[model samples]
Target chain A: MKLLLKKGRLLDPTLGIDFIGDLLIEEGKIKGFGREIEISEKDLEIIDCRGKLVFPGLVDIHVHLREPGEEWKEDIESGTRAALYGGVLRVACMPNTKPVNDAPEVTSYILKRAREKASVKVYPIAAITKGQEGKELAEFGRLKKAGAVAVSDDGKWVADSSLMKRALLYAKNFDLPVISHCEDPKLSFRGQINEGKLSARLGLKGIPASAETVAVVRDLLLARETGTPLHLAHLSVKENLPFLRWAKEEGIPFTAETCPHYFTFTEKEVEGYNTNAKVNPPLRTEEDVEAIKEALKEGLIEVIASDHAPHSPLEKEVEFELASFGMIGVQFLLPLSFNLVREGLLSELKLLQYLITNPSKVLKIEPPSFKEGAPAEVVIFDPEERYLVTEDFIQSKSKNTPLLGRELKGRVKTVILEKRIIHL
Target chain B: MRHLLDIYSLSSETIKEILELSENLKEILERPIPKVPTLRGKLVLLLFYEPSTRTKFSFERACKVLSADTMSFSAKGSSLEKGETILDTVKNLYALGVNLVVIRHNLSGTPHFLAKHLKIPVVNAGDGIHEHPTQALLDMLTVKEKLGTLAGLKVAIVGDIKHSRVAHSDILGFQKMGSTVYVTGPAHLLPEPKEAEFFEIRPGGFKICYKMEEALRDADVVIALRIQRERHGEPFIPTLQEYAENFGLTPRHLELIKEGALLMHPGPINWGVELSYEMEKYPFQVILEQVENGVAVRMAVLLRLLSGD
Candidate 1:
């Protein structure tokens, strides 16, 4: 079969391709790309992508598919379907499921399920510790061999310093990236929201910024000492800036990531006790939001992922403290990250690199590009299209985003993954 | 207002109205027949998720005195133990023609959550370490009854300000009525000053007095909060003994306050930890009067919320 995407502004930062172009696909593979591709074959299919932005499908390194357990919230099928609509063709899901992805068997189960059910590519991230209890380390070698792209105790941090240091070194031997969920459980114990006047006024227990910075400092020092590549996930506080800066100056082998919500909202979102805005490393202050945007601009924070934690009403419809910390974002990842570009914090190509290449590098995988003979993993986005984020608009099973009922720009009009053409 | 969720949401005018209503209601309590027919057939559901004696009984007593029917639901041996969500449990009760809900949950904003979903009014009996709206109202009523007005009074709140919902509400309530609130406790016990600033509360709404004596000196009212031993598992204080010695209100410390200053405690007090037992005998102490005024204040709240006046 011959397929032609005509006259779209194709942008691939990896290949330095930025121009009005046409891309040709044959037999589910990229045939070629040029200023114009005229194909008059017998079985020719052509899609006019006029006035649209086309790029490689986004790769989100952090997402929670909620499968293997708690499929009621989000399974691989629903999660990946949401991702596809957001122009994300690939996602590395976190390991903090009902029964955490600690053992090789769990990782194998996730991959096997992804093979049968996932609409997009799913990379399973195994837990760094057994059951993510922060007590004993998981078998990194066996987990990596089972198709695990990384290891992380995502929902909880490895509080024991010696155990975390050893896990970093041990995961290094297996070539598996160590992703740290930086939070001191003791400092953030029973904490409901960001520690500030908001928490005070609401009378909810506060999670101090030191909870994140303390763990972040410890992890950076551990990475510096061990010389192992480390990835810090969901950094929210400005207090982590100096430590992240010192690590960069020292030439530490580490990559830092912040989510779109970290730059989008602040602790004030919890004013009315809005449970949808409730997130782990709870939404911080406006100052922290500016710092995150600045970090993304300076490339101190390289990757912008959707820490797409989804929760059902069972978890979210309770009291603020009882409500689980999370907001589903895999579906809105691209549109929300596009805000950074809209706000002039990042250029279009730089934003795409953060969504595509930088995250692919974190996972140590080949990013999707319009190379000849490569799989046709592409996204056609209407940058000017605006739509309200509603339950009907969301493809994820859980409709638990604070952005619900709000209008967002940049809609994914179509997604091309190999032979399957998904029109959103 | 449909719901009495927190003191922060109540205006000074509304607070004055409630206090005036309580003063009138307090007269009924001293009469031969203490019952009123204000809410003759209305059913008030007392949903207490945490263990409580005073708050639950106070709400029930308020309901009975107002001639409103009352039903109690405790977390123990209830459907909540069977893993039913609080919303579901409250909805099931709401289906039974409940006129109002007076809820006390270990989680903050549980009453607000219920109030959002239910058409019937919801009253916050006490929620977590968040607020005890009625407790503050009753305390304010006691102060007004004794001192003639809530305005221009100096109030001192001592002990476990961070964990005490009573302190949170009292600070907002007392300040709303034009009183200056001074809070002093172990450094860890007091909330950050930014907490008050976030509410856009006026400057001097509440001051953090580091020294207990500084807070007590020339104070018009002194409220001593109970220190929960369970909360001390994190070593918020070096020891209860050390806390009693330094921050506790003893007879010696009482001399620092104004001659006619009122001593208050939202009780179930840790006898020696926050207050010296000997100090309880002082004539200016209004701890028992605070409890007596609790019923009147809650009665006023139920009438205001349910009767739509």
Candidate 2:
């Protein structure tokens, strides 16, 4: 297969390149990309990319593809398809599925399913604790050998400090990255949204910022003490910032991640008890959103992840307190994150780095690139495009989002992954 | 007009309209024959998931006054005990040609959930610790009857503001009517103002007065909320005795307020817990008046919703 993308402004932050160019792909490999490309080969496909911005396909390190158990909500095939439509070509799925991915067999099962059914690349992050109970550490070496890229207890935090320290040390020994969910369950007990005056008025129990910050502090301290590389996932509140800064200044090996929802929405989204906006480390205050945006701009926060938790109406269409805590986000990852650049907080290249390069670096994977011999994984988008975020537009099976019926800027126009092409 | 889920969404004008309607309904309640033909053919269902006597009776009596037939469902022997969802149960009610549902559940936003699912009108009798719109309206009605108007009154709500749905609704209701609400209780018992702001009742206007003396000082009205015994679970309050002594209203505390400041309680009040037992029959006490106003206020709500106003 040979293809040519012509006259698009290519942005490859990895290659330090941002210019109007033509990219050539032959047999699933990037042959070349430059201001002018000479093609001698006949029978080559061409994609006219006029008035478009092209970048290496986005990489999202946090997504929950509820396979091996909860396929009704989402599976590898549907999740990867949603990610593909969102311009995300690589996804590292959390290991919180039922019959949890704490064992090598589950990790291998995910990889095998991805190989057979996924539209995009899928990396499985196995559970740090066996069954994610936070009691005993899993076989890190075995999980890594079985195709797990990282280990995390993403849904439940490793509440036991000594146990978490041992897991971090063990992961370091095995050269696997440790991801902490960072929540003190005790403080978050029966909590529904961000602890504040709103929760008091709404009468929904609140999960205070201290629940996250206290846990984050403990994990950062453990990471520093144990000398393990830790990746914090789906950080929401401003309270986590000072500690994150302290950790960074103290030369702690850590990468903090926040999702698009953290920057795009606030605790007010849960008003009228809209369960679709309900999520763990619940959408925070405006100050937190501002701080998160500033952290992204200042590079204090290194990665932007989807943290795409999917749930059916069975989980959401009930009373607010009874409803499950999550919203489907895999499909909105790129479009929402693009708001950072559109708002002039970060350049397009810098934003793309958070979406693509930084996540790859955190997981220690081969970064998606627009260089020769690299896989031709690319996404073409129009930042000027605006569309109503209707249920029909969502590729995921679950249409649970606060953004439903709302207008959102930026849309992915095309995706080229190796030998395949998907047009939106 | 579609639903009375909570007081948070009602504007000040709408609140006055409800109060005025309640005032008109109060005349009907005093009539020898109390029944009205307003909702002659309507079927209203009383779906109470939580145990309630006053709210349930108030709603039932209001439905009777409006000439609407009522069917009651308590969670104890109902299919809800058999694991039937609130939606499924409400769907069953709707299938029975029920025109409206007056639901009281122990979960916040249960009415919102039903309103989203059901086509018929839904009135929130009470939903968990979220809000009791009619109760707030009735409290406002009592205030209006005693003070001539709700505006320009300093309304102090004392007791478990954190857990009392009445406090949540009353604060919003009073604030909407240009009344400055001072919510006083123990720091643990006092609700965080975030919930108040969710109703667009911002701070500075609405005060969280942890000191009862300060909250009661020169207050035009003081409504004592029932201190829920279950909320006594620690770190919340050390003991009921401590809560009653420190935050509870007494005859001595009453002197701190305006000379004729009306004292109110959303009863089934725990006597001697939130207010002294001696103040129960005090001339300024409007606890009984609140009950009467509850039925009147609920009648107005039912009539408004059924009339599609």
Candidate 3:
């Protein structure tokens, strides 16, 4: 099958292509993308993408596809569908799902399920520790052999420094990257929201920023000592900035990431006991958000991923202290991140690099490109389409987010993965 | 007009309106029948999620005094445990033709949540440590009845300001009426100024007193809040003895206040802990007047909310 996307503003940060062009696809492979592509084949399909921005499909390294258990919240099929709606073509599923992806069999099972049902590519991130108990390390070689892209005990931070050091060094031996959740359990125990005056006023216990920064410092030191590739996930606090800066200056083999919420919302969202705004490493202050944006612009924070942890109403519609952490964002990830461009904080190319290229680099995969012979995975989006984010707009099974009822600035128009084309 | 969720949002005009109505309602409470036909056909539902005998009875009495038939729903073992959300429960009540809901939830902003969905008025009896608007109003009414005016008064709220919703609403309510509010407790029990400032209605703002004497200094009204016993484990106060000895209202401490300063305490008080036992009988301690004013103030609030005046 041949497919054609005509007259779109092609934006491939990986190939440094930014021009009005036509992208041609033949047999699920990119034929070419440039100005006025010479295509005279009578059987070729054409799509007019005028006034649309086309780019390589986004790659998000942090998403929770709650399969093997808790399918009621989200499964691989539903999660990837949500991702596709946001112009994401690939996602690395976190291993905090039911039964936990701690074994090679579970990792293989996830991949098999993804292969059969997922709308977009799914990279199963296996747990670094057996059952994510933070007690014993999992078999890294076997997990890697089973097609796990990376290893993380994501929902729970690996608290023991010695165990974390061993996990990082052992994963390094298997050429696998170690991702740290970066939180101190002791400091954050029973914490409902950000530790500040807001929590104090709401009569809710607070999770201090030191809960993340202390853990970040520990993992960075261990990563330096072990010479293993380490990626910090969903950094929300400005206090982590100095430590991350020092690590980069010292040439430490580590990369830090921040989710869209870290830059978009502040602890003020948690006011009035809004459970949708409740998340782990709780939404921080405006100063921290500004710092996160500055870090991303300066390239100190290199990747942006949707830490899209979905929960059913059973978990979300409760008292503030009782409600579970996390707000689903896989579907709105692209539109929310586009605000960085609207604010002149990041160029379109730089934002795409963070969304597409940097995530691929973090997972050690070849960045999705618009080059010839590459698989035809692309997205067409309208950067200026304004729409109210209602529950029906979400493709995910769960609608737990503060963004609901908000008028968001961008919208995904279409997604092309392999031979399939989905229009939204 | 739709709900009394918190005193912070209540306009000075609306607050004065509620207070003035309560002054008239006080005369009705003094009458033998103590009942009115104002809301004879209306229905009021008391949905108490937490165990609160005093607040529930207060609202019930207020509804009865206004001739509104009242029903109470204790959420201790209801459909709420069967995974029913607070919204669903309130919606079910609304469907049942209830005129207004008096909600005392353990979570802050629950009445606000109910008010957003329900067409009927919602009155916040108390919501977590966030606010207790009526209690603040009744306290203010009691003070105004005794102290002439609230504008130039110096009001001090003592004990567990961080955990007391009454203290939060009272501080904001009293400050809004042009009174300077002073708050004092152990550093841990005293609210952080930022949280207090968020709810402040006036520019002059409120004060956080380091010493109990500092809070009591020339105060026209002194309000005591119950030091929550559940907070005992966290070392907020090392011991009840230590708390009472250092911060509790004793006769000796009364000397620091103005000669005729009115004393207030929202009932179900931790007797002898926040207030001295003998001080309860003191002429200045208007604890019972606070209770009497509660019914009158709630009657006024129900009338204003239901009548939409």
Give the Cα error of residue A349 in candidate 2, in Å: 1.9
User: Against the hidden true structure, what lDDT does model 3 obtain?
Assistant: 0.87
What would the C-alpha RMSD of candidate 3 be, to one decimal place?
3.0
TM-score of chain B of each: 0.97, 0.95, 0.95
Native contacts kept, each candidate: 0.74, 0.77, 0.26
Error of 2 at A258 (Å): 1.3
Q: Report the lDDT of model 3 for residue A88.
A: 89
* Candidate 3 residue pairs in clash (backbone atoms < 3 Å): none
Estimate, for each residue in B133-208, the C-alpha lDDT of model 1 and write its tens digit. 9999999999999999899999999999888899899999999999999899988788865565654376867788
Chain B TM for prediction 1 = 0.97
Candidate 3: Cα lDDT at A283: 96
Compared with the true structure, what per-residue lDDT tens digits does model 2 show for residues A313-408? 888888888998888888889889988987899998999889988899989988999889998899999888989989889888888899999998
Which digits, one per residue and each the tens of the lDDT, describe model 3 over residues B207-301?
88898888899999999888865533355678889888988899998789999899888867887788888887778889888888899999999
DockQ of each: 0.68, 0.56, 0.28
- Model 1, position B18, has a per-residue lDDT of 94
lDDT per residue for candidate 1 within A1-424, as digits (tens), equals: 9899999999997787889989999999999999998778899888899999999999999999998789989999999999999999999999988789998898999999999999899999999999999999998999999999999999899999999999988987888899999999999988889988889878788899999999989999999999989999999988888888888999999999999899999987887899999999899999999998888888889998999988999889888888999999988889989989899888899999999998998889999999999899999999999989889989999999989889999999999999988888
The worst-scoring run of ten residues by lDDT in candidate 3 chain A lies at A197-206
Model 2's CAPRI class is medium
**TM-score of chain A by itself in each prediction:** 0.98, 0.98, 0.98
By TM-score, the candidates rank as: 1, 2, 3
- Candidate 2 Cα misplacement greater than 4 A, ranges: B193-204, B229-235, B281-283
Q: What is the TM-score, restricted to chain A, for candidate 2?
A: 0.98
